[model samples]
Target: MYGHDNKQFFGNNKLLLPEQPVHDDFLDTMEKVFHWSCIFGVFGSKRYISILWSALILASLVVIEYLAIWKVIRAVTGVARDTSGHRSITARLAGTIFYSISIMSLFVASKLWYYWRSNISLLWAKVERSVGVKVPADSTLKRRLYLVFGLMTFCSMFEHTVSMIASVGLDCPSSLLMKRYVLVSHGFLFMGQDYSEWFAMPLILISTLASLLWNFQDQLIVLISIGLTSRYYRLNGFVAKLCELEKHQTEFNKKSEALKVYTWRKIREAYVKQAMLVRRMDGALGGIVMLSCSCNFYFICLQMFLGITQGLSTDVMTGIYYVVSLAWLCTRVISVVLSASGVNTHSKTALKYLYTYETHCYNVEVGRLQDQLTKDYIALSGMGFFYLNKTILLQMAGAIITYELILIQFDGQGQIDTETTPSIHLNVTNI
Candidate 1:
C-alpha cells in the first residue's frame, strides 16, 4: 500500500542518467593530466618551482608583452606598421570586451583566492557538523577541478600563440594588441624599444601565458565546482530512488530485513554527504558566480562573433582552425549548462519519489527533505539576478542570430557603396 503511489508517480526512466563512476573517474584523471602537461609544455619545468621565481618570470613577461615585442617585430620586418585593420570599430569593440573580461577575471580570481583560503576551513567545519555528515575530501574531484583550471590556462596560451603566429606568418595586422601600442609600457616607466625580435618573442610568449593563467585558473575553479555539484545532485537522486525501492520490498525475510536496514543507512549517508557537498560548493562559489556568469555570457557571445568572422578567412587551414576553436568553446559552455540542468532535473525526480512515498507512509525526514527540495531546487544564480540554465543558451542563440543579420546588412550596404562609387564620380564630372 505504501508504494502503490510509487508506480502512479513515476513511470518513466528516460530522463535518468546512468551512473558510470569508472568512466567518470577516468575522464577526470585524463583532463587533469592533460592540463598540467600543457603548462609544462609551454613553460619550462622550472616555472612551477618557486613562487618568487615564478613571480619574476611573470613580471618579465609583462614587460615584453606591453613594451618590447611589437617594436622588435616592426624593426625586423622593416614594414611601416598599418593600424587600419585593428583600428576598425569592430576590432576596438572586440578588444575592449576581451581586456575587460580578462582584467575582471584576474581581479575576481584574487578575491576568490583570498575568500577560499580564509573560509574553506570554516566551511568544512560546517559540513562536518551538519547532522554528522562528513564529506571526505574527494581527491579525484579535486584533481578534476584543477584540470579545468589547467585547460583554461592552455586555452589562453593557445589563443595567444595562434595570434602571434597569425600576425607573423599570415602578415595579419592588428593594432589593438598591447605589444603594438605605447600605452602602458612606454610612457609611465619610459622603457626603451631597443630590443631585438628574437629577444622579445620568447618574453612575449611567456608573459602572455603567465598573465592569464592565474585568471583563467580562478574562473575555472568556480565553473568546474558548479558542474561537479550538479553531478552530485544526480547522484543524490539515484540514492533516493534506491532507498525508496528498498523501503517498498514486500519479502520481509530475515536477510531481506537486514539488507533493507543496511541499504537504507547507506542511502541516507550518501544523501546527506551529497547534499552537503552541493551546499558547500554553492557557498564557496556564490561571490564569483554572479559576475563570472554575466561576464561569461558576453564573453561567449563575443567569442562566437569572432569565431564567425575568423572562420571566413581565405586560408582553408586558418578557417578550419578557427572553426575548431569555436567548437571547443561551445562545448565548454554547453557542458556547464547541461550540468546545471541535470541538477534541476534530478532533484525534481527525487522530489517526485518522496511525494509519492508521503502519500502512503508519512515520514518526518522525508517531509523535511521535500520541503527543502521545494524551497531550494539546485540552481546556480548570478548574484540572485539571473539563474544559469539551458534558457541562457536560447537567449544567446537569439542574440547571435540578430547580430549576424545586422552584420549581413552592413556588408551588403558596403558592397552597394563600393559598386556605385565610380558612377557617382562620373555623374559629378559631367554635371
Candidate 2:
C-alpha cells in the first residue's frame, strides 16, 4: 500500500509550469550524436571524436574567429573604400571583436570542464537519481530543447541567407568579398562571403555549423538546468503528496510509518543535493555565461546604433540585411536569458503550495525543505556578478536602449561638427 498513516484524502499538488512549453526531437538526435553527454565527465572516450578531436575543433574555431578579426581589420584598412555603405565596416569590426571574445570564453569553458570533469559528473549523478524522481520520457524538456535549437539554427541560417542575397543582389561578387573580407574559414559570425558556387558553398556550410557550436555552449547550460529543474519538480510532487496524506487521516501499520519517514527524508535530501549542485555549476560555468551575456548586450547596443545611423535611405539590399541580422540577434539573446532564468523561476515554485499544506502533515523534513528554499537564493550567476532571470532581461533591454541612444547622439554630433566647423590653415613662417 502507498505510505499513508493518515486517513486524509490525497490530493495531487502538481505545479504545472506555464513558462516552458517546448518539442524534443532535437535533443533526441543530439543525445545520440554526443552520446548523452555535455560535461567532460559525461563524455566517455566512446564518442565519434576523442580528446584530440575536441581540441582540434576548438582550435579550428579559434583560428576562424581570428581570421574574422583579421578580415575586419583588413576591410577597415582598405576594402569598400569606394562603397557608399562604408559605415558598416566599423560596426563589423566592433562586432567581430566581441564575437571573438565570446568564442574564446567557450574554449576556456571546455578546457575547464575537462579539467574538473570528475567532480561535475559526480554532482550531476546525485541530483539526477532519486526515488520517484523521474521526468516523463515525453516531457516538455525534450520538446523545449528541440524548439530552441531549431529556432536558433533557423534564424542563424536565415540571417546568413539574407546577407548573401543582399551581397549578390548588390552586384558585390564573391571575388570582391574575398578581397574585402578576410574569409574566416569558421565561426559564429557570418563573415564569409564568396561569389563562386564552389567557394560560397563551403562558406555557407561552415557558417551554419559554426553557429550551431556557438549556440550549443549556452544551450548546454539550459540543458543542464532543465535536467535539474525537472528533478526538483518531481520531488515537489512528492512533497505535495505528503501534504495531501496528512490532510486526511489514513490508517497504516509499522511498515507504513517507516515508509513515510523514509520518503520524507529522501525528498528533503534530494532538494538539498540538487540545490548544492546548482551552486557548483554556477561556479564552474559562470564565466561562459558572463561572456555570452556581455557579447550579446554589447552587440545589441552597437547594432541598434548602426541600424539607425544607416537607415532605409541606404540601398534596399543593405537595409534588408540590417533588419534580418538585428532580428536574429534579438531572438538569440532573449531566448538564452529566458531559458536560463527558468532554473531560478522554477526551483522555488514549490513554496506557493508548501504553505497551503495541512498543519498535520508538517514535519521536520517539510520544515527544512521550506526553509532551505526560502533562503538558498538559488540562481545561475556570472561569478556573483549578475543573476539570470526574466527581470534581468528587461533591465538589460532598458540599459541597451539607453546606451544605443547615447551612441547615436555622439555619432550624429561628430558628423555635424565635421560638416559645420570651418577648418583653419596655419602658415608657419621661418623666424
Supply every candidate's count of residue pairs whose N, Cα or C atoms clash at under 3 angstroms.
0, 14
Report the Cα lDDT for residue 273, model 2. Answer: 79
Model 2, position 274, has a per-residue lDDT of: 77
- What TM-score, computed on C-alpha atoms, does each candidate reach? 0.60, 0.72
lDDT for residue 421 in candidate 1, whole number 0-100:
14
Q: Write the per-residue lDDT of candidate 2 for residues 1-431, one digit (tens) a residue.
A: 43344423221322221122243332344444243323221223445556555554456546656755665666657764321122244433543564465356446555444634557765564445433332333356566666655666566656656655544445656666543322222211333343344544544444444455555566666665665566566666656665665666545466655655555666666677778878887887687787778766876665566557654555686576667767777877777777678779878878877889767555677777788789888788877999988899789988998887777778777732211111100000000
In candidate 1, stretches whose alpha carbon ends up further than 4 angstroms from where it belongs are: 1-82, 87-93, 128-164, 170-199, 210-231, 234-242, 245-287, 290-313, 346-349, 358-360, 414-431
lDDT for model 2 comes to 0.55
Error of 1 at 282 (Å): 4.8
Task: Give residue 389's error in model 2 in angstroms.
Answer: 1.7
